[model samples]
Target: MKNSSFIRKDIFGVPVLKSEILESFKDLSHGFSTRRGGESPAPYDSLNIGIAVGDLEENVKKNRNLISGISCSERSVYLTQVHGSEILVIKNDSSIPDPDTVKADGVITDCKDLALVIQTADCQAALLYDPVKKVAGAVHSGWRGNVFDILGRTVRKMAEVFDSDPSDIRASIGPSLGPCCAEFINFRTELPEALWAYGDEKCFFDFWEISRAQLQKAGLQADRISVSGLCTKCDKDSFFSYRGSKITGRMAGFICINN
Candidate 1:
């Protein structure tokens, strides 16, 4: 992600992509992880959080532990990420199901100090926060999720659960597939017709703009959104890319209501 006044590097040395907009909200904490800092080795390199991938179980454990320390939450909730529009709700109350058992593409939380995480390689890990309601959401938006409008659905899901209006929510689009590398040889069969306008000289689509349009369609103001335009495929040195390599580590995007 490119640096700007809206998004700045952390002085804490976590090597994360943070949003100045989200950072300004005292009650919340959120960041997108880069491949720079952690314990995984070689291909997993460092900070590989996806457990389902071929990475060692112990390596993933250590990586997750490092993330837990960064968020300062006891544990962060993650979904199975089915690439569907299903939304998992996490209440502030004490009782909640095991997050791993929640097979959904997105998570919504009104809970404090409980981190909500999204795992991704070449897909967008979109983060949403409502300062008015002190609610947050993290979504894994792959092309399939995009076809189903997962980001927009998650916004409305927060409204259903926490009474959060999109106008009151601020968002950050984490790095993922960019237009430069989102080449689709058969977009006519793979992507919907509505998204064809963003196609580049080749068949590559600009998913970043698609995300922005989806968020705006859900009622979030243009100024309230901050997009990290970094393309995971283009920046392999900083992030994991499934398209870049079949075997690669997964980076993370995190959100929580600070205690």
Candidate 2:
């Protein structure tokens, strides 16, 4: 897959979504936001998207609305990422009513007018779309989830649930902590044995490569997948990096079926 760089500013004064790849989806409103435009205070600074991180509820709600205005539905389904392999199939009614409701790593939905949302700081946030089926999915793939091959599983689930063909699916790997900053102390124990079992004994792990590999393993066409090779830790001004700040805000990676 080839990576193209793009940037867009939201009406709310924050950098929301990338521009170069937006041309591919004419029927969807999607964006991967930065921590720049919001009403929250320090720690959460401005555009903090996570509600459970102690940011005021009102502020979080407002932030959500601002981002949603760009490319989401009136009702959006947000996942409670637990760093696991559980992928839930969401319907129109399965939204996150409160911040502490349900927990899952990935979500897939075929219902129109219902957007799929995922939150992340340093973890990988992937958006999958089947233009032929008009179905979209959002996945939060952390190191733990990657070890379990959550992306590959999510692709398979999308195929089973929406009758989507991997060849017809277009995906984007949003900003995440890259190998330059993602250093593991104990490579053998920190990562899955299976990763090392395949002879990846390097000091640092490249999540972008791992994710791209997983997408191909799921039978997705190489040209259909795109990655935003921006490293969260490397670009702190435009994104929030968990490794950069132990206590920091989250960015929203959103995808929706246009009404």
TM-score of each: 0.96, 0.90
lDDT of 2: 0.80
Model 2: clashing residue pairs? none
The lDDT per prediction is: 0.86, 0.80
Cα lDDT of model 2 by residue, 33-94, tens digit: 88887888888877887988888999998888877676647877777889999888875565
Candidate 2 regions exceeding 4 Å error are: 1-3, 19-22, 92-99, 197-202
CA shift at 234, candidate 2, in angstroms? 1.5
Q: Kindly give the number of clashing pairs for every candidate.
A: 0, 0
User: Tens digit of lDDT per residue, candidate 1, span 1-259?
Assistant: 5667336455346687788878888887788889878788889888899998888999999888878878878868978888888898878775667866778998888888888889999999989999998889999998888889999999999888899989999999888898889998888998899988888768888888989999999999998998888889988998899999879999889998888
Clashing pairs in 1: none
Candidate 2 matches the true fold with a TM-score of: 0.90
